[model samples]
Target chain A: MSVDVLINEVGPRDGLQSQGKTLTVGQRAELIGALVDAGISAIEAGSFVSPKAVPQMAGTNELYALLPAAEHVAYSALVPNMRGYDLAVAAGARTVNVVLSATETMNQKNIRMSLEQTTSVCAEIMQRCRQDGINGQAYVAVAFSCPFEGETSQSVVRSLSDRMMEAGAGKVIIADTIGAANPRQVTGLMHDLVGSISAERLSCHFHDTRGMALANVLAALNEGVREFDSSIGGLGGCPFSPGASGNLATEDLALMLESMGMDIGFAAQRLVPVVRTAERLTGITLGGHSFRWLARQVESEEQGGGA
Target chain B: MSVDVLINEVGPRDGLQSQGKTLTVGQRAELIGALVDAGISAIEAGSFVSPKAVPQMAGTNELYALLPAAEHVAYSALVPNMRGYDLAVAAGARTVNVVLSATETMNQKNIRMSLEQTTSVCAEIMQRCRQDGINGQAYVAVAFSCPFEGETSQSVVRSLSDRMMEAGAGKVIIADTIGAANPRQVTGLMHDLVGSISAERLSCHFHDTRGMALANVLAALNEGVREFDSSIGGLGGCPFSPGASGNLATEDLALMLESMGMDIGFAAQRLVPVVRTAERLTGITLGGHSFRWLARQVESEEQGGGA
Candidate 1:
């Protein structure tokens, strides 16, 4: 099937990292199974972070080993530093991701490092991944706004994104860590980024905290971005980031894309059951804004109600 | 105050008409007062229809008479026919609107009239508004997709809109009656509509049932639409129209526009209390997707926590 956009499901990593309940490796594997069944090919499976720091991501390595080994399925995990990158590589990970905060205060608060130090460490990880023949990706976190520092400098985000790309990162995901992005901001930043680094290597991660995620996605898509990061059922946000309410739900993104006559490689309505499964496993009442209308679509179809 | 967009509030009419509980004319006046206080300049006060058929709008004439007589606040009303139009003008209405369903099935089902009959009636009303020197507007209902007839013909919408304009309608509001519009469709149709009719005489009314309302708004905004119809707190949809769900909330639209540095003539945060008043009046939980984040901004500001 032809795919117009590549959606990297991040429920297993970014979504779970901020969750209250820690799913066991087995439970995490179950979630992945449901996502694959719904026609997801690329996913952020887990992270190589410390179990003590993020209990929700504790069993990432074991979860990776248990994930489906389908040739088309691309599973990636987050690595904060060299040790984490080594653990990820030892666990048979083919793709490794590193987070590079764009602001000085965000770096200090998140990883107790200066912006310069975090950027260097991330660049090193990306370089290592390239040497080891791994698909290296970097996230420019808080690319839009910092809760403590107000609006981030556009030039700063631009410089760091260029640095990550220079360090052999195959892709740079611009992440709105605090969900403070609006469409105009997304369009302006995406326009500059796509022009400089090119759109083929760029993706966006937006939060629906202010109900502009889908709009942000549209702006980026218009600017030629072909990939995005979404969570199943709008699962989670960074625990350390205030007001980063919900990740853009996979169902919402998929439905909007498909409804626009764009192919996403699956029937968007089929994800109704997958959202239910996510809710059951995590014990969290979850779904995107479009979940109810999507569920009704499945119901109407089952009862033979014609469009 | 400078205004980049003209928001015609429909809560007093469309918002209350479908409610489970009917508000007295006095209470509806109170809701309008709240909207006006929040910097709303244009409002759809109510409809001059058969009282028994729509009891919620029974006391519209009385309500209009009681409303504030501020020169800056432009209020409008809906009129179904010549008799309704006369009633509206007699009630001191300076602006009047009429609904012209785009699909045959919708016309038959909603008003027991053929599409041609409804169009003629609406055209006559617009013509009359011209002779009377009143501001006339026509709504092309279900302009994107109709529930009973599936996709509405774009050519039919274009021709009818032109007819209404020729007959003296000052503006044509392209309404997504069932909340089924996508950004792709919106962009394509709006491009043609704006090109043919020019952007100055057009507006859009979107519903949030499928979570693409804001996206649609952005698409239309890019096409040069400077007017929109919104309901306070996402108050109501057509009771007769299935799947219409929630009207685009005024607060959500205002916030997104303001965040993008566009002037919407009011502080978006000030709508928090307005939404609360709506909830209190209707006895329903209401707010757009941005409501939570908007509330938090207000809270943070009150606590002197600088953004």
Candidate 2:
């Protein structure tokens, strides 16, 4: 059976935040515009965290102001707390993404909040989002494994997901923050998740640190997960994890899905120019494992045209 | 269910042949000895081709003389014709690997022989191998896609496989020589293969040209095909396909398989030293997509030990 998958482009927010080279708001807008032109419907355009903490995502509000409001595109931003949520709402963000760490140690390390404190903060933000007619998606970071606390159990993730849903989250994304997961782990965790949560409201965000991101995607697809988070040119990595690679490249994921006869709403080849632009702006060599192969295809095409 | 998988290391034969620097016979022996110590049972140690043709494989006879014939190890050599097969027998190779391309263009370009001529030669070699009481494994190169031929039909591969087996090949390896096959293509081809040929007599060799090798492995595993061909440090690309990456790394394959609860007879961590040696010898940057992750693990282990 043919499937239509939703690819949420997270390059502007998740990808840029971890990069060393910071792009200007105009560059971010250009990247987003290219992605929108390529038929990406959902875009995590920016995050509302403190500029002092993350300088790369500092001018997201200005980026939002400069962006064109496309008819089919849904722009979202990451909000860490109630203050950030207010700032996001003021910035004209219609959809907000909130992240809560799955482990207590991770919560302590990342945002310096206990699980109870984080849950209350998320619930308050979700409640405000509902009242303001804004969509809210909760991301459970380190859902698979944590670098500090080690193996995270599925039960912990499930309980956190349940609390987020109760707190008015419309969607929940399970993230492998450190990229330490295997396909069997994905199959086991997603099998349990699909039974408790509907596939419509569940998504997966994977890091390609261990080269299993696409394999994990195949595993999740077997469990009926249709929504995935990817970055253009594979531009993001966890700030806490040293020497880790970026997120799975959007071009690689798109290529695999299209090859499998699944429709992802955009032409995979159209993203090559976008990837090149990202590489130029960020000065980070972005491309997934299939980057060289895609570059070869482009080279061959140009030569063919020249001939 | 606990599954035992066979990992055939092909760095010496397949990897070295494509590399720029040629390792001495002593270095080749040392690499093979390390692999044997790491519990790799089957190894394509060398080829019996002319030194004038492939200088990298020169002095393989001397390497065989220096190697200690371990009880569990099987040292096989690639034999392209009757003369090469005779050399392999003289060198005390108990098992010989014979190759025939699936596409006509690949056969003509690679071996300078037509499909019919290659088949007859392979059948003749297999028949002699049977008389000599030696094991024979036939490799169907470019079984998935050929660089010269756009797409190779499964029917052609199937017919060639039938002919090779009829002529006394004990095992058959389906090779994606150009590393152009995706998971869906692997699933489709392997599904038919597993039904026609017993999984016991079938193996898969994949190159990582497009970064889908491990994903294709997962697809083949789902089809009950267990044996796979890997090279240390991910060495060995197709000599015919320029700009292509090496074969699937033995360390990466071992890591994924062991993590998935499959017993491959040894620890995946044991292959790191072998990979380092391969890098030093071939001077080709080895290691697959998970190279950084594996290196980090090694660092952590060393630090933990010092503490």
- What tens digits encode model 2's per-residue C-alpha lDDT throughout A1-307? 1238889999989998887778889989988988888778889999999999999899888988977789788899999998999888898999999998899999998889998889789878888888889998999999999989898989999998988888889899999988888898999999898899888889999888877888888889888999999998788874434324568889888888886878898777778888898888887666776767777677788889942
Give the distance in Å from residue A219's predicted Cα in candidate 2 to where it truly belongs: 1.0
State the local distance difference test value for candidate 1: 0.90
Question: How well does chain A score by TM in each candidate?
Answer: 0.96, 0.94
Q: Which pairs of residues collide in model 1?
A: none
lDDT of 1 by residue, B1-307 (tens): 2599888899999889988899999999999999889889999999999999999999788988899887799999999999999999999999999999999999999999999999999999999999999999999999999989999999999999999999999999999988899999999999999999999899999988887888999999999998988888888973323323479888888888888889888899988999999999888877787787888778879899765
DockQ of 2: 0.49
Candidate 1 vs. true structure, TM-score: 0.97
When just chain B is superposed on the true chain B, each candidate scores a TM-score of: 0.96, 0.95
How does residue A122 of candidate 1 score in lDDT? 95
Which parts of model 1 are misplaced by more than 4 Å? A238-245, A305-307, B238-245, B305-307
Tens-digit per-residue lDDT, A1-307, candidate 1: 1589988999988887777888989999999999998889999999998989888888788888899887888999999899999999999999999999899999999889999999999999999988999999999999999988999999999999999999999999999988889999999999999999999999999988887899999999999999999998888973323323479999899989998988888888878898999889988777787788888788878899764
Q: Give one digit per residue, the lDDT tens place, for model 2 in B84-186.
A: 9988889888899999999888889887899999999999999888888999999999999988888899999988898888888999999998888888889
Best by DockQ: 1
